[model samples]
Structure formats: structure tokens, C-alpha cells
Target: MLQSDVPIRVHANWRPLDPGVLGSAGPATYSRNFAGAPLTNTWYPIALANRIAGSDLAPNSVDINCNFSSVFNNWYFGTDGNPPVNQYDLMSVVLHELGHGLGFTGTMTVNNNGVGSWGGGTAFPVAYDRFGVNGSGQQLVSTSLFPNPSIALGQQLTSGTLFFNGTAARIANGGASPRIYAPSPFDPGSSFAHLDEATFPKGNPNSLMTPQIGTNEAIHSPGAIGMGVLQDLGWTFTTAMMADDSDGEKVGCCGTGKSAMMQDLKMPDAEQARLVDAAVELTKASVDQDDPKFYEQLSQSLMQLKQARSESIPVEPVNDAEESRRVFQPMRLRTTTPETERISVADDPVWRDNFIKWLSLPRRDRLRIWGGAPVLAGEFEHCVAVGGGGRFCCTGTLVAPRVVITAAHCFHLGCIGSRGEVYFGLNSNNPGTGRVVACKCVPHPDYKLSTDEHDIAVLILDQPVTDVAPCPIATPSQIDDAFFLRLAGFGLTETGRSGRKMQVEVVVASNNCSSSSHQSTFGCKRDREIVAGGNGLDSCNGDSGGPAYVDVGGRFLLAGATSRAAANSQRGCGDGGIYVRIDKELEWIESVVAAEGLSIACDSEDESEEQSNSGSVKKE
Candidate 1:
């Protein structure tokens, strides 16, 4: 047995054997001191040993028995007399006998006439008896119906067909139940206690515990069925102990085959246990209706475990490339940006005045845009209204079915206290169209009111929004040199209350651009912040946390979140505003999504390459 922290006492003794029985190995005797007591410790059914039945002082033979209550230790091999060879491996025999001492043998005692009795009829059935069933599916202990219960049970043990009813054993056997040894003409110590020799012939991988051992054959480890039977007998084991040969062939004691088996069995059972525990936890916390992927992941882990045991192989480490491919990738959406010659607002003073007037108006009077019309139906469907009831405190963008990205400051009133309900498609006045309550809100840990460096938070919806698809996020490389962008939101506009969603065009401004107060503001950090809107169109008070989109290969990708209006601009919504760059926080976003088990697909280069190839083919 493997070394354990628990201490146990074992005693070994040897006596001279009769030469006539030299071919036979001795039995492993055990006594249950605390009969009927619960097995709470590693050691139980303490073992005791008697003299060897083989030739006296034979170097090729070993006569050692261990306490099943204690771990097997101190294996000593004999060097005198007929020394060990490929035919007889002293260590292999010792381990096999030790397995017998550890509850592998049946508790039934038989007489010359094949009559049997168990524990002097004082104790309940042992662990081995629990799985024994006759051909008629009747339990072995129910032999009271016979006039001579012992004789009837003995006859059954010698000739009747018996099956093991352990669930794990059945599963391991490919749904075919496992059978026990029961040959004609009752044989003591070998009949009821072993697997039938006829069923598991010599060279059969599962013949470890059979009644007879073949000459010149060394069986090193218990096969898969053997391990499963032990499990049925309440013997706990690790995945390594349960490992088998890849080809399902028995391994001999002397070659590299035995060494390889031992090596494969070295995987710590604790690691497998941890995996099982994780699977259980995921199962308990999973919402089957909300995420079917949870079940998929759990199934994958289970399959790994099954593969580990069936093939006697260790769990393979996950490949980074494979893992990257498995992660969710966001889908890019088609944009409606017009390709016609555009009008520049650089010299348009009248439009600038109109934008200022729109911002200066009352909240009830200001529209989402100065001269802009309602957003083309279903254009910015990923945009959501953030707040409770028919009122919205801010705007947000959905990057995942259950995840919404918004400003950290929006939760100033405490995310829970704000009691917000995210509206996925709020183009109309109907609140019932796409409303979902926020289940959780997570803000960037480094976010601060003073610096606003990490002004981002993600809201988890109570239920996934399936009607509208999420918007694809932009990478730093895709948005760094962007000269123009489209801002969309349900914030205040010239039309008042920003009742309907609206979009406007904005131009990227210089980094040094400051507000009217002459304070160096709108400082654009390549990774953290972006400055935009030198044009007449700009975000107003209610537009904070809304999306700033850039055209990437004719698709609209979310580049940033509306952060703040230009402090130096004559009107807060007129000149330029600062937005939190999404590319800067991609790592944090990915981490949070993974930790929460929220699925969000990211754009993949492989998909882009495939599209490129298809387009080239079309062009040809």
C-alpha cells in the first residue's frame, strides 16, 4: 500500500512448510476485533498471518500477510533457494496476497460437503456479501429458505452463477455485470473467494485474483475489474491504483511493462479528487436553463476522468491554443454608416451653435441629438437603457447575452440601491420589449472618482437577452488611429428626454485639447482614454456609459464608452468629450467574463482569414 500519514501496527511471522504443498501459496488470515463497528478509518479488518505452505525457506516464495486495517509496507524478497525469475516474482506474489488480506476474499467459511457459515452467524454480512447475487437475483444472505442454509450457500458458491451488483463495476464492464468464481466440486480458500478461473483464463488481464496462478507467469497489478470489485467491497482507491494496461493485456513482473504500469499508477489520487469536486460544485451552482455550456463543461471533465481510468493514462494538460479556440468569440455586426460623400462640420458655426443650444436646454426639453433623427430601426440594438421602471439613469452596451458594459460612476448610488433594469431594445416607449433586472454589478477594482482612470463596470442580467445580438468590441490596433466614430445613446437631445435612441457623427480630436476652463482635460492615453468629438456633434449628460463605435472592415465595433463631456467647451456637449477606451481593459473584461462563467465570443483571426479567402474567391 502507498505510504500514509495514519499510523498502524502490523506483525509478521514465518514457520516451516510441508514440501508436498510447495506449489501452493499460503492464506492471509484476518480478525475483526470490533465486529459490526463502522469503518471510519483507513485501517479495518486487521490482518494476521500464518506459516508458508510452500517449501521451507524457499527463496522463490514469499509468506507474508498484512493487516487490512493498516497500509501494506516493508516488502522483503528472498534471495536463497530457488531464486525469483520471470516465472515467479516474489514481490508480485506478496502484493497479490496483500490484496487478499485487504478484503478481497469472501467472508463465507465452507465445510467438506460445501456447507458454509459466516462470522458464526453473529455479525451482519461483510462488504463482499453486499454485491453477491444468485442467478435469480436473490441476495446471497437470503439462503435461509434452504433446509441447510450453509450447505445450500456452499453448493451455490461451488456451482451456481453469481453476479456482482456494484454500479461502478457494471459501468466499467460496459454495462455487462461482473461474475464471481464458482466451480464444480467445492474447493476451500479458492471457491467463493476468487473470480472463476474458467471465465478469466490464463493471460487474461483480469485474472489477478483467480484461484490458481500459472507457472512462469508473474501478475504484478490488479486489472480494472479487480479494482472495481475491491471498490464494491468498500476499498477506496485513487485513479492511479485503478489504472490498467493500454491493450488490456496482463503485465509480467520483470520487464519494462511492469515499470511502465507502476509509473502510470503514480498519479496522485488527490488531483483526480479535486477535479471531481470542481465538477460537483459546478453542477450544483449551474442554472441549466440559463447556460447549457455549464453542462457541456461538466461533461468534458467527466469524460476526462473516464478516459483516465479506462486507458490507464494520466490526464493530459490543456493546450493553450486549444483553450484559446474554445473561448467565446464576439460576433461583428454590419454597420449602416453611409458611403456617400460626407459633409464636414469643421466650418459650420451654425451647427455648433445649435448643438450648444441643445445641451443648455432643460433635461425634459433636450433631445439625444441636435439635428439628428431617431436611430434607424434596429441599428444600435445592442444599446440598452440602464435604470428602473420607465426612467433610465444612463446608457449601456451589451457585449454578451447576460453581460452589459457601462460606466463605474453610474453605480454611484450603489448598484443594488440603484435597482436598475437593463432594456435591450428600448427604441420605443414600451418597457416590456426587452427589460431585464440586473443580478450583479462588478466595477473595476482600481476605479476612483478623482482620476476616473478605470471608470468601467459590468452588469449581469437576471436573464440572458436573446432577442438582440451583442456588439463586437474593438482592439487597440483597430481604433488607435480612428479619425471618425459614431456615438449612440438615449440621453438628452434637442428632441427632449432622449425618449428614442439617436446616433451622431463625431471627429477624433487632439490629445492636448482642454475645456473652456483652460484645464488640461480630455487627456488621451493610448490604452486608457480616448478624446473625440471636435465636430458639432457630442455626448450630453445622459450619454455617459454609452458606446462610441468605429467602422472596422464595414462592421461596427465598440471602441470606447462615453466618459465625460469636454470641461472647456462652451457647452458640455458641444466640442469634445473623453471616453474610456475599451481596448485598454480587455484583459480585465476577459477575466471577469471567465470568472462569472459568462460566455462572450471575441473576434478570431482565423474567422477573418476564412472570410478574406472567400471574398478573394468571389473576386476571381
Candidate 2:
């Protein structure tokens, strides 16, 4: 609780963001050219503004998309140092995001050409910007030293050396100014808003506000410099010598693996929020909620959405998914598309460098609908989210202690080496909150990107995983045209959310082209592929490289791997999905395990005997 005459009211919500952005906050309301003050349009994050104004100013104060942590990757909720590596502290990230909402940002920014500017390029510095200065004590905002926005000012922004000139903060910093982040080429989201990471490295009391966080890192308090900066920004303490940092994440940095640069987009405040939301809304089937209150809200939103024509809303097409050369890249032209079909961006591969492009679309009214339901906690343990090389996109399943099976297309042309980390978890609600295991991946020799033929890969883990049992592989004889498959993935759904594990059952719509019922000329018969399309049940983004299972008795056997949306489908997901017939590739799968000098997963004599003696194959 804050000791204010009124109170600080903050409004925040959970929504999917780009891979790295954790959360974002800032002024919901800005005062332009104030009559009395030092700076014009000095922006204040909503939290601070609320404390002074004594009322909530906007619909929501902060927009947090730590959705990656809840159900996705390995983010440590504990402040203790037990998980020594790859753990991104959840509380630390929240505090950092909250810190921005509470005014830990500056107005300084540099363009691609290294020209610096402040006050949103209009001489209107943020409230925090008033105290900024260079290492030599020259105020960056002072007209006497530099123009409002100039190459000279830009040089100072990326000089790798800048500081906050706040008196209290300087005093807290041992009489020297508090350093700020000013890298060249200016990381637009991180440059001026955060403290310099090096000068106040992750163990310092002032590191909570830094621009990048490494894995396994956590900060429990906001540090001394944070309070000092707040003090300099007009916040008063009842009795202050140094001030209390009961404002948590106290020090510089906590723990982590690699330095990851993350920033939440300023919400409701940026002009781009709606556009981003529109982009997100176009990709799903519908919204869902298990909680009563949220469900009720969603029910209302659904009705309102049903009455409105979605085509009325203009969406700026963003080619975020232009890459990855999606296997189902063949799009059904609109002229022939049924009017009932909703737009789907599921086939788009645009998940990278997209945080800033996201606009604040309504969190509740989004056009998300999932044909699948959330799986119970303990089920589908073998399913995983696969990411590496700075891209957090596909999904995979554990087939053995050290082997993961996913789509060959998930990786680049040649699986020359280990691709990236394999995440072991059911959902990803925060930025990084899943148990991670490193692995080396090799795609099938016959895999073809052009026709998506033989789309399969065997990812061999660097070490064995003992906690989760691998999914048993089905023998070639067990699969046929009469197939009912279980689809599981940590991918996007109708709720405008991804990274959560969802399960759906779909029937084999078509297998061989010769018997008629062949879905499309785009090749249902192309390269031993199996087709499964449901009206609203199928896999989408983040589910690539995932497994499709078939039941034999009470056990589910791995029968296929998620390849892409059906080439003939109207929407990306929910209409249908293509799967690589894994039963046909059993020989190749074992060959990879044996060649890698690792014992094959789930092919042991005991398991085979247990299965052979078990009941006959059953369909769902």
C-alpha cells in the first residue's frame, strides 16, 4: 500500500505479446505545455499520475503480456536460487514492468542514423527526462547544451555513456550521476527508458531498472537509485534519510543464463495498440474463459461481436509470418471463399520483432475461438515448446529420454547442428516459464520444403530428461485410413492466447488421393501426408513440430507430427491441419536414435510386450 492521501490505482490485463516483451506501462493521460513547469508534455506513467490526480485516468493502467510465463517456459516464481540456470524470475519481471508504470522511463531516443531526440520529438520531455544529463553534468534537455532533437543529441544517446542528473539519485549514487542506457543504433524500446546495464550490473541495488535481464535472474527490490529517482520526480517520503525500498526487487540483478532484452509496449497510450490487436484478432477461431467473471464478460463480448461485421474494422496487414516458408503457404483466394469464413493469420510466420507493432486491441472482445480445450495439468507431459537462436516459435514432443520428435520444417533447410532449447511444460503465460533442456536436431534426409514432403525431425537432447515419460511411437501396421487422432500443442487458439497446451480430437478427412474425397490439388497425397480438418478444431502457430496421437487400447501412440494448416483450408487453424505420418517414418525415427549413439525411446521389448498383450486399437 502506498502512503498517499488518495491512492494509486493501476489497471492491467494479460494478452499475448511478441516473444521478448514482458510488460509495458506509461501515462494514460498526458498534459501538454503545462503553464508552470520545467518541461512541456512531461509524461508520467499512469501509476504516478493516478497518485497525484487522485483518480484512475484510463480504461487500464498497464498492459502485461507475461503470458509466456504462466504456461510456456521455465520462469522461476521463487526468489531463491535453487534452479541455477535458464530460469527467468517472474516476480522480477513484474516489478520491472511495474517500475515502468511507476515512472522509471526517460524521453530520450535515437533514430537509426544516430540522431538523438527527446519529448516525443516535440520538445515535450517525460517527467523523468527533466533530470537527465551526460556524464559531464550537462543536462541533455537543456537547450543551451543541445537542440531538442539533433544529431548532436542523438550522439549523446548512443554514446554508451549518459546519466540522470537528479540530485537525490546522484547523492544515492555516491555523488556521481546515475548512468542511463544509450547504445548506438538505439534499441527503440530499450535505449532511453532503462538504466545502463553495465555500470549498475545485475547485482547492484540499482539494477532492477536495467534494459536486459539474463536467465535465472531475479531482483526482489527496486533498489536505492529507484527511490532516489522517484524522489527527484516529486514523490515525497514521510521521513527520509535514504528512503525505504520496501518497493521490492531490491538490488541490481538476480540470476539468469543469457541477457535477454525485453520491453512491454505502452498500452492504451500508444496510437498503435488497436492495430496490433486487430492483427491478433484475425488469427483465431473464438474466445474462451473458465473463470466465472471472465466467462461472463466474454459471453457479452461474443454477443456484441456477433452483431457487428468484422469487415467494418480496418486492419493494417502486417507480414509477420512471411518467413518460415510455411508448408501450407498456398492460400485460398477470397473470391472463392465462403462468406461464413472468418479471417485467419494462423499461416503467418510473423512472430519476431513484433512487440512495437502490436496495437492495444480490446483484451476481451478479440476474435479468438479454440476448437480445443485446455488439457488437465498432468496429461500430455511429453508435449513441449521448442525455441532457440532467439526465436521462440514451434512445439515438439519427447519420444525418448534424450530425443524429441517435431516437424523438420520447424528448423531451417539443413539441421546442420543443435537448433535451440526444448521446453518441458504445458503452458507459457509468462515470458520464460518452462523447464528447458538443450538439444541437437537433425531433419529427415528426404524432407522437402518445396512440397513439404517427408516433414519430420529427430531432436536429440544434450542430456536425458527423467521427469516426463516419452510418448510411445506407433508401429507402421497400427495406422490406416480409419484414423482418429489426438492433437496436442502449446499454440495459438481462439482466445487470442498461445503457449498454453490445448488438446483436440480430429478425424482423418482424407489420406490417399486415388479413392476420391481428396481435399485439394495442393496435394493431400503429396509425400505420405495425412489430412485432418475440423470446422473449428485444429493446430495453429506455436504448435508446429508437435505430435498427433492415435489410441491403441487405453494408450495413445504417436502417429503423426504437426506440419502446417491444410493447403485448401480457408482459415489458418480450426479448419484443418496437415500432419506427417510418423507411423510410416518409424524406421527413420529409430535410425536417428541408433545413429546418435542413444538408446531408442519407447521401443523397448518390455513396452512392446505390454502393448502386444494389451487390448486392440480403438478409435475416439
Candidate 3:
């Protein structure tokens, strides 16, 4: 339940006890940042990277595990608990564990045999491991000085004097490197991974992450140095988030809390058991019915029921020529034929450029959003063209053989004639080649035309597309760990108009309205959209409704769908734009597909494809 540049999803569960652990959480997977760019390779927590791509990319970014057994049950759920003495604050522990999962622990590990290695056996170090140094400021991971997997690195791990070299963290620690908890004994889980406990004693502002929790203590926020390290990790906070550490001396996030009473009291095991039992009883005590906040948070579960209008099925009505005038006989057959013809005049970039200017990028810098590399032949076949007679108004992704996901804005009569044509393959010149006519369009119930919130729609296709394997809709976890967004579409190119599909990688700007780059300048609300792009790369004219993908391992997952130029983009393409975070629309998508007589159950064969030619696409 945290967000930085984008929406972040972390699900928590009460699980059986793991010995000597109260709670634990970390990224489910990790990956190399990118290829053919920049510095030495760096690994990123896959779930954190997905946050930059789209929301709800998978079920959750970090799977949280907390002990809930009777043996580990002496806990206070919130600050208002009675007789809170001897009780551990669950919120404080949760915050501390979340801090680590978000990005704290590293790959460095020390073996008992006087040897140490980083990367957890990977080829590159994680982003956090890059800033570590020894007592004399020697880089721990560098082969030039401290060769990896050597006695030198091991000595540094147990040196009792390691420092974080990040400039931001140093500044936060009073212009000096923060002392790390590298004890002589070298505990694998604690050594070299935390702030020295003595330096920031219990209740110190930066003690929340000191590797230990104390009874009767609660940290209100991540202390100053914690924010600094996260800043060094490339996370930017809003003004309010930054304001948490302004006072400095508070016993909050990243700081120590109340001293360990049990550690000092030396009570007998029987006495400790009695105290634990009392704490458990406290949890079961009745709540104060008059507590307004309690009642507010305890709102009853709700279920909304509505009757939908019966729409026309697969057959397009020839009831009126104007309404069905654009209907083609392809709807009458289950198969299509390819031809050696150019794209239709309506969709031809060259033809459209003669008058209309934008597609995803606005026409005036208004419509489809870019100048990017042309896709390889037969690549991204599931990213189809949406419109008729080979003339397309927007782009879409095939989620199922008979289901296509597109922007709600593209569901109008003028845009795609309500029931429009869908074309597959790189060239849509011949409507016969893999063209699947759409029979119905279903827009989100809460879709807002004025704000573009929930700017998504579903199109039920007339026939199944067997050749092109559909993309798997991303889950919340996948979205949070995405490092980049692959914008792919049959859009306008720099040469004015090429029917070939184009794509470019856009950096995620913000995932929510509050942090949107254009929030102040344009009052742009990315509430329904995810902001991404910049540096001369973007989805542009004719790229509307395109698929924005995230590569999970080697498989490309559908993270979002191109909607329009970002609310803040004055130039449309390069300045960055917005895309519909398709992940958040999973429920509506499943419902629509089900209503249309399509079976797209998440874990079913509909989401699976052969791995030989097309990249793998899975729901998980």
C-alpha cells in the first residue's frame, strides 16, 4: 500500500511461524536492468521495476509473511491498544519489513569459511550493493581492490566498520557516511545490512531499521536516513513524503524505539509465557463501540447489482445501411485471406498525414502518441490494428482468440463505427490477412470522458485468431516490478506515415495523479492513466490503443494500453504521455469476455501459447 513514481502493490498474509522470525518480505524475483545501455550491469527487484510500467501487473509485488502462531502472538495491532507494555507494535514491524522488501537488503553474503561473495550468485550486483565500502573506504565489490569471493571481502563484512557511500545518505547522516552494523561475529542476516544499533539507540530517529524490534515501541515513520537511502535508490518523494523527516530527532522510521525490556529484565521462561498470554488477551478485548475511526474503517462489505442492456450479438445489423454500411462480409465467414495491398487510405500514415495530424499524439500534437524503431516482421502479432477496411483508428492487444482490449475512447461510432474491423500482423494493407471483425464494444461503467479515468474498453471479436498468441494481462506483482514500458503500435512515424508497427521504451514518470509531472503545470490527472515517456521517445500518431508491454524474464506481459498524449505533454509524443493501466481493469475485462461467450480464465489454456515463435505470455 505504498506509491512512489507509480502504484506499488504489496500483499500481506498471516502464515505459520518460521523459526526465529517475526516477519519477512522481499522481492519474489530480480532481473538485470536492461541491455545495450549505460554502466556495468545492475539487478533490480523485479516487482519494484514493474511499478514503473503499470498498476496491478500481478497479484502483488512482494509476498509478505508474518508469524501468527500462538507461540509468536504477543503483539499490539495499533497505537491505541490498552496496557501496551511488553507488546510489540505490529505496524512498526510491518513498516520495517516493508522497507527492506521495497529495497534494503542486498546480495552480499559471508560464509563461515572466511570467504564472502555478492550478487547471490548472479552476474551483477543489486542497486543497493553498489554503494557499500569497508572501514578504509575500499569498494567491497570491485575486483580491482577487494576481489569478490575472497578473504578480503569476508574481513570487510566482519570489520565492525562499514559505510554506505551514497551522497544523499551521507548528507542525511550529517555529511558523514552512516555506520553499518558489521559486528565481529558476522551474523549473515544482520551484519553489514543495518544501521549500527549503538550509534542510533532505541528511540533515535533512525532506529526503525536497526535489525531489532523492542517491546512497547512504535515508529511513526521511516526516519531521515531511511528516506535518504531510498532517494539514492532513485525514488523521488512528494513534498509531503519528504517532510516526514524535517524535525530530525524523532524516534520514527529508520530509528530505534524503546529499549529491549526482556533483554534487560532477564525474566524466567514461565514469567515470559505469562506476559505473552496477557498480551494475547489484550488483542481479544472488545473494541470501544463509540470509536468513530473504528466504525469508519469497519464499513460493511458491499456488492453492486445492475441489469445491462442487451446488445447485438455477433451479427452486425443490416437493419439500416448507414449503421451497417461499413460492415464487411468477413463477419459472414470464420476465415480471412491476405493480399498484396497497402493499408487503407483511412489508416495509411501517409494518407492520414495529408490532413489529420495525431493518432495517440494529438492531431495538433493531439491523437495517437512517436518516432520509434519499426517492429520486426511478424513480431507482436497479438498487438492488432483496430478499425475497418484496413483503416484503423486505434491499436489493441488480443487477450484471447476472440477478445481484444483497447481504449474506451476508441469505442465511439465515429472512431470505429461502434462495431469495427480488427487487423493482425505488421501490415494491415490487406484486410483479408488475419482480419477479425469486432461485433461489440464494452466500455468501463465508471469511465469518465472529461477526465479519462478508467479509459479502457473491450471488443468481442467475430472469430478466433489462432496464429497470433494473445498477450497475458499482467497481475499486480508484475506491474510493480516492471522496469520499462514497451510501447508498440501501428502508428505514425517520423517519415510522416508508415503502416509498419513502431515501438519505443518510455521511462515511467508517475503512476498516480498526485505525483503526475503535469499535476501542477497542466493539472493533468493520470488517475485513469499511467504517465511514461520523454527524451524523444513516445507513442505517437496512429499509435492509439497500442499495447504497452513489460518483459517478465523473457515473456512479455500486457501492462497497459495506449490511450492518449499525457495530460501534461504539450508536444504529444516525445514529451511523454499516458496509457490506460490495463491491469486495473481485470475484473471488467473478465466479465465482458464471459458475457461474450469467451473463456479466458486466468490460468486456463486461453492465456497460454507455444514458446517456439511468439514470446510466452502467462497470467501469473
Least accurate 10 contiguous residues by lDDT in model 3: 300-309
lDDT against the true structure, per candidate, is 0.49, 0.55, 0.54
State in Å the error of residue 548, model 2. 0.5
Better of 1 and 3 by TM-score: 3
Q: Write the residue-wise lDDT of candidate 3 on 293-345 in tens digits.
A: 32222210000000010000001001112222232111000111123321111
**Candidate 2 deviant stretches above 4 angstroms:** 1-372, 389-391, 413-417, 428-432, 512-522, 601-620
Considering lDDT, which of the candidate structures 1 and 3 is the better prediction for this target? 3
TM-score against truth, every candidate: 0.37, 0.41, 0.39
Report the C-alpha lDDT of model 1 over 509-530, residue by residue, as the tens digit.
5454332212344433434666
Clash numbers, per candidate:
21, 61, 57
Question: Which residue segments of model 3 deviate by more than 4 Å?
Answer: 1-5, 16-20, 35-40, 51-70, 80-83, 240-620
What CA root-mean-square deviation does each model show from the true structure?
30.0, 20.5, 22.4
Q: For model 2, give the RMSD to the true fold.
A: 20.5
lDDT string, candidate 2, 1-620, tens digits: 23345345544544333324444444322432222222333444434444555554432323112222221245676866443476667667777776664566655666567677765423345667766777787878777688866888988777877887666676688877788877776766577668787787767878888876666566767777877777666555665634333444222111001101123422122323443444335333253322333322322223223212121110010111311211221111111223343222222222111111221223322222242245557888898867664234677888778888887877753222455777776544322445777788888887656656667888888888888887877655555523456778767654334555767665465442322223343244443667664445467877777888876665787878888776556655665677877766766876787787664444233346534433212211
Error of 3 at 605 (Å): 48
Error of 2 at 365 (Å): 24
Error of 2 at 553 (Å): 2.9
